[model samples]
Target: MRVRLASTDDSPAVAEIYAPYVQTTVISFETTPPDAGQMAERIAATMPAHPWLLAEEAGTVLGYAYAHPFASRAAYAWSAETSVYVRPDRHRRGVGRSLYEVLLRLLAAQGYREAFAGVTLPNAASVALHEGMGFAAVGTYRRVGFKHGSWHDVGWWQRGLGGQGAPAAVRTVTDLEPSELARLLALPGERR
Candidate 1:
């Protein structure tokens, strides 16, 4: 298996992997499965500022991970939010870890100072992944999200990047407008 930056062609497969979770699980709060077009747009939007990485083997996509703005304010510019999803059949194969490794490196190279992960409750794999990757547990937001007829807690984790020579308190947090996300998403990359 290998991890690579995702492209437009990966959208449909990515959506297929996420659709079941959207329809059958509470891992993601989004209630409706996004169509391929919407998923493609999402891919486009996050590709620039953050990497949308895919884990594939023999041409089959097994998992994906990406980072996005934690907040849109310019003050939050150096901070990011992370999300990861893996094919149910492919858990524990290191795909999530591989994807996250690439995702963090890319974000750091792009000048991000810190990465934030919001792991939905009851998911020990995700929680372990973040911790294993050196993300410190900041806190958990109790019942901050609702899905599948119940409340869900979000576990927060933070990993420092870049700024090795700077004070941890000096990281900039930016509030990105939706337009910036859209624009960044449209930046060019190797198509496949």
Candidate 2:
């Protein structure tokens, strides 16, 4: 198996892994699954902010992971929210862990100070993955998200990227202008 940054070609496979979760489960709150083109655009737009990764085995995509803005305000620039999904058949084979390991390295390299993982309630595998990746369970909000005809809770987990103090030459993600961000978010290949 191999772990690497995803490209336009990986979207369809990623979407395949994501479809069932979006359609039948509350693992993801998105009600509609994005088409291949839009998923590719999403992957492209995250180039600067995060790294979208795929775990592959013999040319088959087993899982994917990525990070995105935790909040848009300047004060929240150093933080990012992470998302990871694995093909149901590939679960327990370490795909999610590999993807997240790569993601953390990429986020730190991009100068992010903190990373967040929000797991919708009852996702034990996801919660375990985050805890195993050195994330701490900050808390859970009750009834914050409603899906599947029931109230759902969101679990928050956090991890620090760098050492004790903030690094020098800080260029927060919010430092960029709206147009510049739009350009990044609108990049051709990956825009979910």
Best by TM-score: 2
Per-residue accuracy of model 1 over 122-163 as CA lDDT, tens digit each: 888888999999899999999998888888998889999766
* TM-score of decoy 1: 0.83
TM-score of each: 0.83, 0.84
- The TM-score that candidate 2 achieves is 0.84
List the candidate 1 regions with Cα displacement exceeding 4 Å: 165-192
Best by lDDT: 2
